[model samples]
Each structure stands twice: as C-alpha cells, then as structure tokens.
Target: MVMKVLFAGTPEVALPSLELLAGDREHFEVVSVLTRPDAPSGRGRRLMPSPVKEAALRLGLPVLESDPSDPSFPDVVKATGARYAAVVAYGRILRQPVLDALEGGWYNLHFSLLPQWRGAAPVQRSIWSGDTVTGATVFRLTKGMDEGPILSQSTVEIGPDENAGQLLDRLAQDGSRLLAASLEAVGEGRARLVPQSPGAYEVARKITGEDAHIRFDVPAFAADRQIRACTPEPGAWCLLHAEGGRDDTGLVLHVLRARPLPADDRAAPRDLPAGRLARTKRQVWVGTKSNPLELLEVKPAGKKAMKAADWARGARLADDAWCG
Candidate 1:
C-alpha cells in the first residue's frame, strides 16, 4: 500500500530531499508542495518563484502559497489526505493542526544533530561554534521547534577550511538519503523515536548584518569563525582607513579561507603603531588580537575576490596599514 506524502520545503536544501521523493514515487506521492510566496529579486525587482515551487510545477504538482501561521494552511494540508508530511528547510513552523493532519506523523530533515542546534540557522551556528563534526537528523516533528524525537542520524566530519555554505550543501545531500531511509522505516513499521534529553540547548538564531562585523580586538580565532559563518551572504568585514587619512571606510573584506597561526607568531596590530601589512610569499597574514590570520583569499571593497598574495602584490600595503 503506497502512502500519500505531502512535502513542504524551501531553498536549495529542500531540493535534494524532493528529488529523493521523486525517485521513490512508488511508495509516496507528493500531492502538493507548500512554499513561501514569491518575492521580487534581481536588479529589475521582477518577481521570482521559489526553487521548490518551480520544481513542484515541473512535476505537475499543485503548489500552495500560504504562510504557516495562516488559518488556511491546516485546511490545505488536510485536503491532500496525505498520510505523512516531510518538512525540510521549510522556513516556517508547523503548528499542531498541520502535524496532526498527517496520518502517521510529520518528519523533519534538520541540518544538525538533534537536541543540539535546533532553531533558525543550524548550519551557520555549527560553523561559527567550530564543531569538528556535525550531521543531519530525521526526526518525528512535534509542537516544539526542532525539539522533536529523532529517528535516524548521519555524521559528517567538518573539514578544516569548510564554510557554512559549502558544508550545508554536503549536509543537504546526506539529509536527502537519511530522509529516504527514515521514511522507509516508517513505512515498514520499524520507526524508532528517541526523545531529546533535558538540558541546555543551543538555538541557531538568524544571522543579521550586525552579526557579520569582524571585530579586530577579539581573538583572531573568534574572528575567523564569524568570517566562515557569514560567507556567501552578509560577509564578514573589517573597517579600514582609506588613503589620504580620510574617514574610516567600510571595507568588505571577505575571508575565503584561513587558519589559526602559531601561538608565538600571534601579534596584535595595535601593539605596533598602525598601517602594518604582514606578508609571506604564499599568503598575506593579518595580525589581529593575540593571533595572526593567514588570509588564503580575500575580496577587498569594489573588487573581485583574489588570493591574498595577489592582493598583497598589487596593493601598496604599508607595513603598518593592516594595523588599523
């Protein structure tokens, strides 16, 4: 007996899971897709459909546009008569009515391990926290936010130089497979739900432009985390003094990659007077508080991203310029 399934997701992460459902069409039917309303984009500000909604349309499935908090959402899902609902990166909370509408239960594909990082921005939070290992979880959805019972999980080792965007892409692929297996378990009556243990949980709050500023006074390692966390979105940048001793300019310096320098080599730019450009043949290292950040790649304001070595060669970086 095939189980009718309703898939609700938004964003690139949701695409892989949707593909998995499409592949296993024999066991599940994606009755309809629920996505956020279209929004204006690009320089022209033309309205654009979401990737999820577009995929749903290509598959000839009905696409519903409604806020999760709207009174009509539960009714829409109920009309589908789907036995199960798969929620992934949906960007909206599922109320009790939507959860109860499913015959079996609502399963969520979360980017982080259950009970750990459960909230708005799991992937970004995990990278910022410097977790050596992180993974995805398929859990039985509950009234609480990501505070549901876990069914299965798969771990991914964090690479030394991986950023939030890169790591999230990998996690999304893993999550697709994991979600498929979890659905199989549910179909076969072998689904096991594990409730989260009571303790302090780290919430993944939405990152803001204010959160992306790199503070030079902080330890270089701390600054490195913020740089990785805000990549491909609100970039992490340091304020730099433009030429002619004019007012300070907001230089959008994107740290493409970096690593913690040796303890003995750590030097704060303030320790020296100012305007310092510490460099090496391969990479130009920037001194912050306590430690030095080896800038593997950087994008200066109004410029294309280039290697630190290239930037160092082209720009006349004073030995004390980087100090500020």
Candidate 2:
C-alpha cells in the first residue's frame, strides 16, 4: 500500500525532497504539505509565499499551515489521514501532540551526521570546525532538538575551500535521495532506528551577524575558517580604514572569497603585520598573525561584487589602509 505522507518544510532546500516524493506517487502519497505561511519581502514589503508553498502549488498538492505548538494541531494532522510525515528544514520544532498523530513516524532530514552538529546550523558549524567530512541523516523526529533515532545516513566530503552556502547546497541534494530511501525502507518493513548513545555532542548553534566578523589578528587559517563559515549568509564583512579616504566607520567591505597563504618555512616569521592590506597587479592579500590571506573576491562599499584586484584598482587603496 502506498504510504500516505504529510510533508512539512518551508525553505527552497525543502523543494527537492518534496518533488522527489511527489514524483514517486506509486510508493508515497503526499497528502498535504505543512509549511510556514508567507512573509513580507522586498522593498515593497509584499507578502511572498515560501519556496515550499510555491513548489507545492506548482505540483498541484494540497497545502496546510499551522503553528506546531497550537493545541488544535493534532486535529489538523489527523484530518490529512497521513500515517507518516517527512520534514526538511521545517523551521519550527514539532510538538509531541503532532508526533503522536502519525502512526509510521515523522522522519527529519538533517544536514549533519547524527550525534554531531545536532542543531539549526549544522552545515555552517561543520565547515567552520574544519571538518573534513560531513553528511546528512534521516532520523525519527523526537522532542529533543535533532536528537532522534537514526534511520539512514550518507557521507560527503567537504571541499578544501567550500563555503557554508556552497556546501549546504550539495548536502540538500544528497539528503533528498537519502530521505526518500529511508521512507521507502520503512514502507518495506525495514525501518530500524538505531538509538543514539547518550553523550555530549557538538551543538550547531545559529550563526549570527556578530559571529561573522573576521579577525585578522588570529592565525590566517583560523581567520580563513571564520570568513568561510559566514560566506553567502551574514557574509564576511569588515570596516575599511584608509588614510586618504573619508572616515570609513560606515563603509562595509564584504569579502566574498579568500584563502590563507601557506606559511613559508624559510621565513623567520610566516608573514608581516596583521590587518594591513597589500595588493599586486592581479591579487589582494591581507596580513594575519601567521601567513596572510589572499582576498579573491570582494564588494567594496557602494560597489558591485568583483575581483579583489578590480576593487583595489578602482579604490587606489592607501598604503596604510587596513581591514578591521
């Protein structure tokens, strides 16, 4: 029998799994999708539907909305007549009443491996920690934040310089396939949730704007990790300080791409003074406590994102100008 399933999620990343399961109608029936409602967006502040809602409409599936903690939410879940639920970045915690409404169980597709990075910002945290490997996990939904029984998992290698956004994009795709397989296995009576061992695991706390500030006073490698973790989200930003330029207190310099230069063993000290900006014809490098970091792409204040060299050429960077 095709499993009647309730799909719940809110963001663009959720679309892949929803589409995957929707296409496999013979095995899983997506009775309805539960997602956060539209929110005001853009300069006009017009209400815009979530990516999941947009995809659900385009796929001709029923859509539902509710706060999970609402007392009457159980009735809403029961109304769908769904035995199972699948969630991907649903953006809200599931209340126990909602979990009790499903017979097969609620399965969550998380970006990080189980017992590690178990929280809202797993993908971002894993990259920041210099983890060589990270993956996705499909686990049974429980009250604890991402503390659930493991159903299925798949591993992925983190590229040497891959930023959080780029890595998360790949994980979302890999995770969609893993989620589908886990649900299918359950339908085949092979669902076995390995109970997670009770222990202290790394918690992936949310990445905030304050956390995105890059500190060149630190080792180049450490600063590199901080910049990469914030890329394409809060974004690695700095205040520009130039001798000839106007007071740059309000000038924001966005560093889109950068890498730490390998320390030279022959040199007495790896690199020069920290925070100083230096440039060549084709590249811009920022000094750190150890080896300097190469700034690849940057968006200077009131400028479009471009190669770091291009920004340097236009700005005619002051000799003592530093990034803070």
Clashing pairs in 1: 274-320, 275-320, 275-321, 276-319, 276-320, 276-321, 276-322, 277-319
Total clashes in model 2, counting residue pairs 3 or more apart in sequence or in different chains? 0
- Model 2 C-alpha lDDT versus the unseen true structure: 0.88
Please provide, for model 2 over 81-109, each residue's C-alpha lDDT reduced to its tens digit, 9 standing for 90 to 100: 99999999999988888899998889999
Predicted structure 2, TM vs. truth: 0.95
Question: Model 2 misses residue 63 by how many Å?
Answer: 1.3
lDDT of 2 at 249: 70
Q: How accurate locally, in lDDT, is each candidate?
A: 0.79, 0.88
In terms of lDDT, the best-performing candidate is 2
TM-score list, all predictions: 0.90, 0.95
Backbone-clash count (model 1): 8
